[model samples]
Target chain A: MARILVTDDSTFIRRRTCTILNRTGHEIIEATNGNHCLEIMQQDKPDLLFLDLVMPGLDGFGVLKTLQDAGNTIPVIVLTADIQDAVRDECMQLGAHTFLNKPPAEAAVLAALTDALAEGERKA
Target chain B: MTSAAHSSSTRQLNVLQKDAITELMNIGVGHAASTLHTLIGHKIELVVPEVSLITLDDYHQLQPYEADELLSTIWMGFRGGFEGNTSLIFPTDSANTLITALTGEMDDSPELDELRAGTLAEVGNILLNGVMGSIANMLNAALSYTVPEYMECSLLNIFRKNHTGNDTIMLARTTFAINELKVEGNILLFFKVASFEQLLISIDRELAI
Candidate 1:
C-alpha cells in the first residue's frame, strides 16, 4: 500500500476522503490546507497527494507550482470541486499526474491510485 | 440613508473591476460544484452569468421572488483584504429538491428535517468559501471565513439581515444545477460598501499585474 496525503480545508471532506482511501489499504495523512500539506510533504514524503484547489492560504495551484519549481516529482492527483477543461489542462501542465472531481467514486479512486503508483514505479 | 447615497454616487465598477470579480467568482463556483459532486456522487455544474455592482435597494427591485417568499438561506462573513457577507439563497422547493437529490431520500422523515439545516449549511459553506477564497487569492489577500449559519426565512428578512444602510453588494447572480437531477438553486455575494472599495483597489492591482 502506498502512502497518500489528503489535503482540504473542510474537516468533513478530509475525513470522508480518508475513510474511502482507508478501505483500499493505503495509509492516509491529512492536511488542513495548502501550507500544511507542503509542510507535511517535506517531513513525510508521501508517494501521492490528493489536493483541494480552493483553500485559504496557498491554494492547490500554489502548491503545485511550488513543487514543480523545486523539482519535486511526487505524483499529485488533484481532487477538486472546481470546474472546466482549462483548469484540468493547467494542473496537468504543472505536473499533476491526473485530475478527478471531488468526492470521486470508489472505483475511480482505486484506479487512480493504481495508475499513480504504477507510474511512480516506472519512474524509479 | 446618507451612506447609501454616498455609496451610490461611486458605485460604478469599471470594466477591469467587473472582469476581475467575474473571473474570481467563476473559479469559486467551480470549486463549490466539486464539493457537491462528492456528496451526491454525481458531477455538478454552477455558472455565474453576471457579476454586477448594485446597491441593495436596486437589487430589491430586480429580485424575482415576492418579499414574503420562503427562502433557504445560508449566510457567512469573510475578512481578508476586505470584509463582506456571502450567501446561498434558494427558494424553499429548490432547496428541498437539492437536499433530496444529494441525500437520495425523501424529506418525510423527522430526522431528515433536522438534517436539512445541516446539509444546507455544509453546501453553502463549501460554495461561499470557494467564491470568497478565489477572489482573495486573485487579489493576493488572505481571507478567513466565519462559521456558516443556516436559516429558513422570508426573502425580505434575509435581505434585511444582510443589508446595513448603504452596503454595496457585489451581486454575482449564480445558477447552480445538477443536470442529472434537474435541480437548480441561486447564490448571491454581498460586499459591504467600504469592503467593496477595498476589493476594487485590489482588482485594479490584479489588472495591473
Candidate 2:
C-alpha cells in the first residue's frame, strides 16, 4: 500500500476519501487541515497527498508552499469543489503537481494516484 | 435600532456584494455543467437564478418539509480559510432524480442508491467549489476546501445544527435541468469576516502579480 496523506477539514469527507483510497489499497494518513498535514509530512512522508483547497489554519496553498520551501518534492494533488480557471491557474503556478475538481471521480482519483506513484518511483 | 441600521447597511453591502459573487458562481456553474455534460455524455441544462443572501436563522423558513433523512440530506462538508459548514443540498426526490440523470441509473435500485451519495457529494463538490472559489479569487483571496461529505436529513435540522456562519453569508439559487426534468436547489457561499477583506486584497495582489 502506498503511504498516502489525505488532508481536508470535514470529518465526513476525510472519512469518505480514506475509505475510497483504502479500497484502492493505499495506507492512509489523515489531517483535518493543512497545518496538521504539514506536521504529518515532517514526521512521515507519504507517497502522495490528496489536498483540499480550503480549511482552517493554513490552507492547501500554504501547505504546498511550506512543503516546497522545506525542500520536499512529494507529489501533491489538489481536490477542490471549486472549478475556476483563475483558481486552477494560481494553484498550478504555486507548484501543485495536479488538479482534480472536488468530489473527484473514481477514474480521476485513480489516474492521479497512478501518475503520482509513477513519478515518485522515477524520483527514487 | 443600531442593529437594524447595521443589518440594513450590511444588507445593502450584501446586495452589492452578491452580484459579484453570483456572477462568479455563474461562471463556476457553467464549468460544472460542462463537466457533467462530458462525464454523463448527455445534455444537462442548468438554470441559475439570481442568488440570495440569508442569515443562518432564515434557513428553516426556506424549507418546511423534511424529506427522508437517509435519502434527503445531501451532506457535504467544506474546509477553507473561511472554513465552517455549508452544503449544496437537495431534497430526496430532487436528489435521486438528479443522480439518475447524471449516472444513467434508476433512482430506486439498491445499487444506484448505494452510489448516489458519492455522486451527489462529487456534484456538490464541484458546485460549491466552483462558486465559492470564484468568489475567493475575485476577491484575490487564497482559499481551499475539504473533501465533501454526504448525509441525509431535514432541511431545517441541517441548517440549525451545522451552520456556524462564516462571518458573512452569500447564498444563491441554481436549478439543474436534464432534458425535461428539473433539479432545483440553492448554492450557499459563506466566508468569514477576515477572509472577506483578505479576498479583496488577494484580488489586488493578483492584479499586481
Compose the digit string of candidate 2's lDDT tens values, residues B90-175.
65677887777766667476765556676777677666666666555555444545556677766656655544552234444455
* Weakest ten-residue segment in model 1 chain A by summed lDDT: A80-89
lDDT of 1 by residue, B1-209 (tens): 12112245456776677777777788777766666676776767765447665655664543577778878889887776788787788878778888777555685678667566766776787677666656665576766566678888776776677677756566665777777766677777777778888888888877787
lDDT of 2: 0.64
Q: Judge candidate 2 at residue B167 and give its lDDT.
A: 28
Residue A14 of candidate 2: its Cα lDDT?
70
What Cα-based lDDT does every candidate model obtain? 0.74, 0.64
What local lDDT does model 2 show for residue A68?
A: 78
Query: Which candidate tops lDDT?
Result: 1
In order, the first chain's TM-score in every candidate is: 0.95, 0.93
